[model samples]
Target: MITDTHTHLYSAEFDEDRAAMIQRAKDAGVSRFFIPAIDSTYTNRMLTLEKENPNDVFLMMGLHPTSVKENYLEELAHVKEWIDKKSFCAIGEIGIDLYWDSTFIKQQQEAFRTQIKWAKEKKIPIVIHCRDAFNEVFEVLESEKENTLRGIFHCFTGTLAQAKQAISYNMKLGIGGVATFKNGKIDKFLNEIDLTHIVLETDAPYLAPKPFRGKRNESAYITNVIDKLVDIYQVSYQEIAAITTQNSKDVFGI
Candidate 1:
């Protein structure tokens, strides 16, 4: 079974066809969908998604770095409150994001560290969303390193050295549509990294794969990712699916 280790299934983009979209993923052999949080605004939508797909969906609670702003503390409180009150698979999609604005870099760093501490305390994993801030993200992970500080580096598109560094910190490389891009350098050396350290994701409604690239993404297109991995690792599609799904379970614990 394919496990989309990271997917924003509740994004407004799926509002009109969420159920059908999920069905398509199942039809495509995707059995698990791990949902990440953007901020408190999307919390209810996320829970509603889980309610509708209880057997196949898992939830994560955290304040997204991009969502870090003037009232970031309040947002972080929302994340911590939900985390304390319910069972979540992980504490993410959290981490440094300098891709857009760096005005709140300090706040982003604080939020990343705080959430990492919470995830460590709960013994659950973290799903990072590092964007143009690998060094900053790595700095936090490095300082917060511990036996329980483990997770998936969501949407990983880093150098081989960065990939190995993330693995050293107990993170699985979350491979997605980027791997299918014509210039997605990761695919060139992905075979060098063992499949055991890879996990598949679509980041749906965002980074769709080739043939469907530049279009709206969905879990149904996860097979495109699997197909890419099959070529990258020179393994069968079934082998790539099983191995990456297993890698996801290793991080999410479900």
Candidate 2:
């Protein structure tokens, strides 16, 4: 059974056919999905999604970096309230995103660090949402390094060295649609990294894999990602699925 380590299955993009979309994924062997939080706004939908598909849907709590706006404090509070009351798979989609505005860089850093602390305290993993701010994110992670600081570096788009550095911190590289793009460089050096440190993701409603590139992504599209890895690692599709899904189990403990 294939597992999508990261996917926004609760996104409004699937509103018209959420059930169909999920069924399509399951029919395609994409049976497990881990959902990340954006903010308090998506909390109810995330909860309802899990409620409807408890066996297949697992959730994570955190304030996404891009959502670190003026009311970020309130957003963090919302995250904490649910965190204290629920047993999420991870604390994630957290980290710094400089690809957009840097106006709230400090706030993003603070939020990232705080959430990381909460994750450590709960003895859970964190899913990082780094974009154009690897150095900054690494610095914070460096300061907070500990035996229990483990997670996925979501949508990892970085160099071989960066991959090694992230792995050094006990993070598995979250491979996604970018690995299928001709210009997506991760595929070039992915074989060098052991399969044990990689996990598959769709990051759906965005970053759709090749052939579906530039279009809306869904969990069903994860097979395209698995196909690319079959070529990159020169392994059978079943091996890729088994290894990556096992890697995800290692990270999420689910």
Candidate 3:
């Protein structure tokens, strides 16, 4: 009954063996798959995947931070268009990214704030994608703090204080392959945080767990993440699975 609260199975990297990878994940007890949006370009592919695996795959809509550029207004409009027409699990993979380019920092912040409004209006959870911009993310989140602005901090790799700050906004921390890396420091900080605020993810076709590190990742690899959690928290696999799955359901209502 393992749940991969976040993944990107539709990426071109999985083109050849997508079905096989998903089947392997199911066989490994990775039953739930939450698909995130990269941008408008992948919308059709995302819908196609959801249509094929409606029972296991859930969809989210938003403009990813890196995708925020000069034409960000149009991207935000597209996100709103989808939310207004149909139901999505969340407003996700959205936030600030200064790692790649700082040229659009201001635009990224503006776009993130606009999407936050849509998430609040639709009463859906948010999935934040933070990289080299934790302070920027916290700034937006702090200003928009409210009951409806609840969600997960995808691929969290911040300090214990940052984790607590995110929790204060009624958000969950999305733990993934990074936690299993040999030099990964996420586990050190995560051990200090409450598991009640943790959710499992693969961020698939990327961030593969150790032993499988640097390899193409998929939901099936989440088993490795679960194994690490058992050791970190000194709890049974089933116990960690059950609690994390429940935590995911509490946030996504899936």
Candidate 4:
């Protein structure tokens, strides 16, 4: 079975056919779905999705970097409240995202560091959402470096050097639909990285693989990603699925 280590299944984009979408994923052998929080606004919906899917959906609680705005402290407080209330598989979709807006870069850094510390304290992994801020994200990670700090670098689209650096910080590279894109450079050197340090994700409702590129993504589409990885790693389909699924379990402890 394949595990989508990072996917926003709770997003409103799936409202019309959420159940059908999930069933399709299961049918495609993508059985595990790791849902990351964007902010407190979607907390109830995310929990509701997990409640409905129970065995299929797992939740991670954190304020997304792109959501770090004027009242980010309040958002972080909400994240802490949820963590204190119950269990979470990870502490992310948190990191730096300077691609969309740089106005809150400082706030994003603070939120990222704070969440990373919280993850370490809770002994749970983190799922980072980095976009055009590799140096910035690496800076915070370097400062907070420790044996306990660990997680996945979601939607990894960096060079080999950055991939190694992220792995050095105890993170697995979250390979997604981008790997199937002709311009997505990660595919060029993915073979150099071990499958042990890679995990599959779709980042659903976004970053669909080739042929489905620019279209709204769903969990079932992860097959396209798997196909791409099979070519990149020169491995059998079952081997890729088994190894990457184990990698996901390694990071999330689930």
Candidate 5:
């Protein structure tokens, strides 16, 4: 079975046929779905998804970097409340994202660090959402480095050096549909990185693989990504699926 370590399956984009979309993924052998948090706004929807698909959907709670605003502390407080109230698979989809707005970079950093502390305290892994702020994310991770800090770098599109650095900080590289893109450079050197340090994700309803590129993505499309990995790693499809699934379990402790 394949585990989609990161997928916003709760996204409204799939509202038209959410159940059917998820069924397609399961039909394609993509069974496990780890859902990331955007903020308090989507918590109820996330909870409902998990409730409906108790065995298939796992949840993570945190305020996403892009959601960091002047009142970020209040959002963080809500995250803390959720952590205390229920169980979750991880503590994230949280990190730095300067790609959109640099105005709240400082708040993002603070929120990231604060949430990292919560994860460490709760002894749960974190799933990071980094975009155009690798250095900033790395700096915070470096300062908070310890045995307690463990998670996946969601939608990893970084240099070899950055990949190694993230791994050094107890993170697994989350390879997604981007790897199947012709211009996605990670595929060029993915073989150099051990599959053990990697996990598969779709970031679905977002970065769909080639042929489906620029279109709305769904978990069912992860097969395209698996196909690309087969070529990149020169391995059997079953082997790629098994190894990445195991890698996902390793990171999420599932």
Candidate 6:
């Protein structure tokens, strides 16, 4: 079975047919779904999704990098509260995002570092979201490096060297639809990296693969991603599925 290491089934893009979409994913052999938090705003909906499909879905709690703003301290407090109150699969979708606004650059760094330390304290894995700030994100990861600081670099689109660096810190690369895009640089360099360092994802409601590119993405489309990996490794679909599923389990312990 395939495990989509990251997806946003709670996204409004799938509001019309969330149930059908999830059913489609299962039909396509995506047996597990790892959901990342965008902020405290979606916490209730996320919890509801988990309640509906406890065995199929796993939840993570954190303040997304882009979501870090002037009131970041408040957001971090919310994250900490959730962590202390319940069990989450990981501390995630957290990192530096300079892609959108540089205004919150320093604030993002502070938030990212704090969350990384929190993850270590909780003895949980982190699901990172690095965008337009690879070096910045790397810097934080470097400072936090230790046996305890480990997680997945979600939607990884970095160079081979960066990929190596992430792996060196015991982090897995969350490969999604980007690997299937025609001009996607990730696939160009991914062949050089071992599949063991990879985990499958869709980043759903976004980053849909080719033929479905630029359109709304969902967990069911994760098959296209797996298809790309099968071509890259020249392995059977079942092999890719099994390996990635095992990788997901290793990271989330589910």
Q: List model 5 lDDT by residue over 165-206, tens digit each.
A: 999999999998989988899998899999999899999899
For candidate 3, give the lDDT.
0.92
Model 4 residue runs over 4 Å out of place are: none
List the candidate 5 regions with Cα displacement exceeding 4 Å.
none
**Candidate 1 lDDT tens digits, 84-160:** 99999999999999989999999999999999999988999999999999999999988999877789999999999
The C-alpha TM-scores of every prediction are: 0.99, 0.99, 0.98, 0.99, 0.99, 0.98
Off by over 4 Å in 3: none
Candidate 6, residues 156-203, lDDT tens digits: the string is: 999999999999999999999989988888888788999889999999
Best to worst by lDDT, what's the order? Answer: 2, 4, 5, 1, 3, 6
Q: Which stretches of candidate 6 lie over 4 Å from their true place?
A: none
lDDT values, one for every candidate:
0.93, 0.96, 0.92, 0.94, 0.93, 0.91
RMSD in Å for all candidates: 0.6, 0.6, 0.8, 0.7, 0.7, 0.8
Minimum summed lDDT over a 10-residue window in model 1 is located at 244-253
Per-residue lDDT tens digits for candidate 4, residues 38-120, read: 99999999999999999989999999998999999999999999998999999988999989999999899999999998999
Clashing residue pairs, candidate 2?
A: none
Instruction: Kindly report which residue stretches of model 2 are placed more than 4 angstroms away from their true locations once superposed.
Output: none
Residue 180 error, candidate 5, Å: 0.9
* Candidate 3, 120-159: lDDT as tens digits: 9988899999999999999999999997678999999888
What's the distance in Å from true for residue 150, model 4?
A: 1.0
What's the C-alpha lDDT at position 226 in model 4? 90
How much does candidate 1 score in TM-score? 0.99
- Assess candidate 4 and give its lDDT: 0.94
In candidate 6, residue 107 scores what lDDT?
Answer: 92
